[model samples]
Target: MLIGDVARRSGVSARMLRHYESLGLVRPTGRTEAGYRAYSSEDIRRIFHVESLRSLGLSLREVGRALDDPGFRPSELVADLIRQTRERIAGEMELLTRLRRIGAAGPADWEDVLQTVALLQGLGAESAGRRQRAALSSGEESPVPVEALVEAVLNETDPNVAGALRWALERSGEGGLTLLAEGLGSPTAEVRKRAVQAITEIPSGEATTLLRNALTNPDLVVRRYAALALGARGVADAVPTLIDMIVEGANDVDAADALSALAADPASADEIATGLVGRLAHGTVEPSARRRLTQALADIPGTTASRALADLSHDEDRAVALTATYIRKLRDAR
Candidate 1:
């Protein structure tokens, strides 16, 4: 059969058939005299198998591996895939639970209405992104509308929803950031946080002053968000300020997040980890600070990080001890 005939019989698109071929997941039996690829009925059967596995959430790579190995047990692979899917579903459920809590705190006002719309749009965009990522990772043809979907979500609006509509737009990406920056001065802290988060999505020298000013806001949530934005923007200059917060600030979670961001840059990670170790050795670091510092060090993953985590794993604090164990497992995995 030709590609189209195989696609028709298998219920997979020609594009998807080509994708599976590219991944070496399926192959044409031969070529016709005029050079068109010829697929056999068995090839179409394989395509059906591929589609079935994809529907079950197995990446094409996993499917290919199974197809390549005659001794591979399909039941065992499915069981493992199911376990991973369950864990991911659980994590998403937890996030949804938190979102529900946040939503319940507000009444059905213009802001709430906009937020509801934005949330729905954001969910759609995230789902689409996940599908694309999975397909790309598996070398499969993904039927995703990357640009169109992004543009649509970024342009959606609801006048009665107040700032809620803007939330979805901002979360879309850089374009959303532009819309978010326009509403930084809204009376609501949630709005302010969303705006700051959006602006910080892509860091530039131009955003430094805006983020710096936000960092000093009296609202702890706003300040925490600003610190996070600084890290996302990859502003190296923010490292010293972040280190100061981890060493002396009250919001441990924000400090930890900043440290994680700083750790993304090797130079910043080294500086912070070295300073943290000195603080720990001198007995000046608080228990909470020490815990975050250890996590930050573990994230950097080098000689300094290894040494710091090893020391913390044996620390008197139970939290530090647990973090150290987690760090060791990460290192061992590598």
Candidate 2:
């Protein structure tokens, strides 16, 4: 077959075939009567082979080495191709995400697009200060996409940056609630915790509803966070979890504070005191837990809390007695 026929049949252009010949990747076996490059069957086969290797991302030089170097090992080269392919895919995916976020922002012009891109880059910057500044300025001018804020908040390790990101999301309205709710189900414990924490900052009823749903989440950390946020919001549903936190001694002080906050309501006060007193009365309650419960009840008003405190003040456990006695005196002083 002549060069044209070889090019037409093999799908390799004539110019490319000539280039390959120059590079010794493939050379026509002979010349036709017109002095046209004529490829033998074996030469055409080598051309297909070169094309096949190039499809796997091999450079021309590497392709030549692969075909001509008998000593070349394919394992290392194949592994390298795999690594490079993964890297390319990751880069492309990241670019696609940025484009989607920018489009979601509904940029009015090139300047808007540029500003959105800069804010996005800032959100992902290595320096925490830059990221924090980006988060703080997200709502100004061209607003950073809510999805980007949610992504940043979920992945952010810096406390300052995370807070700013959450604030940005709150200003973005409930747009990020769905994404944050999805984060609540992430397999990563840290992600679930971040999701609940971010949700806590949004004062929307929808956000409150999401936190209510999160109350039943399998993660204890998520449940505790939701309970704390809910308690602060005067949601009575968090009372049980708050009591449990006090019993487990996990963030027991904060849990007591949350319970105290919930107890501000007249109807909630008796229920809160009852829950704590019940825990104190449990036979399985540890001495430390009993003391924490007694301390927790001291903040609760009404006859129920006062009665529980009076009973605990004379209890057999000396530390519990001392703590409850001290709390009763404070209550009397009030």
Tens digit of lDDT per residue, candidate 1, span 1-334? 9998887777888998888889899999889999998998788788888888788888899888877888989999889988999999999996685465335434357665454434434434435453233223211121112232233323323222323333333333343334444446667666666556545544455556677777766666666667766766666555655666666655655666767777777887777677767766767667877776676566664578777787778889999889988988988898
Evaluate model 1: give its lDDT.
0.63
How accurate locally, in lDDT, is each candidate?
A: 0.63, 0.93
Worst 10 residues of 1 by lDDT: 137-146
How do the residues 1-334 of candidate 2 rate in per-residue lDDT, one tens digit apiece? 8888888999999999989989988988898788888889999989989999999999999999999999999999999999999999999999999999999999999999999999999999999999999999987576999999999999999998899989899999999999999999999999999999999999989999999998999999999999999999999999999999999999999989998998889899999998888889899999999988999988899999999888888999999999989999999999
Worst 10 residues of 2 by lDDT: 133-142
Prediction 2 global C-alpha lDDT: 0.93
| Residue-pair clashes per candidate | 4, 0
In model 1, where do residues sit more than 4 Å from their true spots?
1-164, 167-198, 201-205, 216-219, 240-258, 278-289
Using Cα atoms with residue i matched to residue i, what is each candidate's TM-score against the true structure? Answer: 0.39, 0.93
